[model samples]
Target: MAKSLQARKSELSDQEMQLKILSGGAFETGELPTFKAQLSKHKIQTLRPKTFSILQLNIGYMCNQVCSHCHVDAGPDRKEMMTRKTMEECLNVMKEFTIETVDLTGGAPEMHPDFEWFVEQIRLTGVSEIIVRSNLTIILANKKYHQLPGFFAKHSVHVISSLPFYKKNKTDSQRGKGVFDTSITAIKMLNKVGYGQANSNLKLDLVYNPSGAFLPSDQVALERDFKKALKTDFDIDFNQLFTITNLPISRFLDYLIASENYEEYMQSLVDAFNPTAAEDVMCTNTLSVSWEGKIFDCDFNQMLGLKSAVKNPHISQLNQNELMQRELQLSQHCYGCTAGAGSSCQGSIA
Candidate 1:
């Protein structure tokens, strides 16, 4: 493992470098409490799947901006993408299983060549919800994508975006130079299409992740602060704020290692473990599908190459019952989900 990590250090993209550091056992201090033991102490003998309802499809790892803490390590250089064949398989899974929500993610899911086509196809299946996890700035990324807001509104697509902070310096420091301004411009554009309006059915939600090695503040309180600030400052209105805990993986793990705060941060997650939150972790209901068709317990596990604990790890190989019967692949990174109020794509669990 050490030799492999050393080899990767030479040409590893920052994203792969972090995963290598983790899989190489460089970040496991042995001093922190094991996540499973925490479960046992709280009488959770086993973590099992509740149902298979949310189908999260990662279209590809291509993105326009390289954020400091992106778990996918997606940027302009990534070449891996989902083909129409794989997407057809995913759509079949959705139809056969009657999956309630179809979650679309990516470096910028919109960056996928077949993204819009995929959404159009999924809508025809009559799925309840189609969520597009966007980076916000992508709406203003290029002239070709200018029509995205109206397109989303026309389809009633639920939009969830990343907004690190309401201020410029904090947001720019984490995302990149000029990203904050571009994001704000994108928000206004969405508003023009009724994305954040109160009476509009269009749902526009924002996600906030801490910029450093710490758990996020309360979701409800932070949402209040965000609403007041965005309204007074930019007249922006959105449905909700999802405060996500930064998992110790990918670029975030790199930041923790470089800053010499890895041990402390790991301990922080361990100390905040909530059994109630453990019961509702997103993995219990959602199955994450990689760009190439591999299935995972969740998006974080997808990044770490922790495939589902089933015989067949790809979507094309497994049926719905086989998926729900599979156990989750857990690791130290899971502490991010069970810590504090607990975190998921939706927000706090407890």
Candidate 2:
């Protein structure tokens, strides 16, 4: 049998592996502008948390399809999944804290055996909204997950799915063959459930990530293009289009190294660094919890094995007090969030 993704991940720290991948590049110390120094120059050396409104939980790394730019490298081959026990722990945190939003992500969060149960539990905790970072393809991967659209609507779950481009060829090139067609079908299904309707409380949003080494086009322009193209081509509508920069990590990192675009891409990110965006980076407000209950400042950090600044970085020891005051762990990949118009889980910061 093949080794599970988690089993392979456990063999070595992701951070160490990332260093090895960028070994021959211009990523040497003192070469690139340090994220902290940029913040300090802006006179906001330390980023503090505001109200803890969002709880971002990474359920696991098991998905229906593997995309080129997927930072998690999740696919059908991954067997690591969150147990009901860990989910129960997450529910406990939600019940204890006044967290208003719960963002569930994974290889494909819907693939988790206890996904529905966890969503139901968190909804009972009175979270105002739940965001599922769906890959789109999963909604139609099989009969088991086909009912996800209605299921999501029933619970008022906000769906934020990835549709790399409004065009089929570009999207399929980055995601997989026939992904664009399935994604359009999925969007139409979501629309049928009143997800993207103008007055519906059920919200459906699309996320756009650049398919190559370049930074994303202007978010406003890209959103306009996506809306026009998708509406014209598929008769589909969504609440909003979020443009996220592809962070330099995971499979994307490998692509950068292989194509010898590592230096140029990193330089572009650093050159386009916007300090304003850094102040409101999602990590400052959201706490990322891994499948096994480990905690990090953000999902990117989670993938890189950069733990939270809290002395006890686990869901069991979640300390809102310490977490609020601790400094975040940042690396070159953070430039992805600060480049140009600024990127975050939601969309552009400024």
| lDDT against the true structure, each candidate | 0.85, 0.85
lDDT of 1 by residue, 1-350 (tens): 01222124523344455455554443455555577767778988778799888999998988888787877777777778999999999988877886899999988999998988999999999899999998998988899899999999989999999998888888988899899899989999999899989899999999999988889989999999999999999888889999999998776776788899887888789889888899999999999999999999999889877889888888888777777777788777888999999999988899
For each candidate, give its TM-score against the true structure.
0.94, 0.94
Clashes by residue pair, model 1: none
lDDT of 1 at 134: 89
lDDT of 1: 0.85
lDDT of 2 at 69: 79
lDDT of 2 by residue, 1-350 (tens): 22333444632226677855443255556677666666777897677776678899999999887787778877788877888888888999998888888999998999998899888888899989999999888989889999999999989999999999999888998888999999999999999989889889889999999889999878888889988988898899998899999998887886777788989998899899898888788987899999999998889988888898888898888887887888888777888999988999998987
Report lDDT (Cα) of residue 227, candidate 2: 88
Q: Which ten residues in a row have the lowest lDDT in candidate 2?
A: 1-10
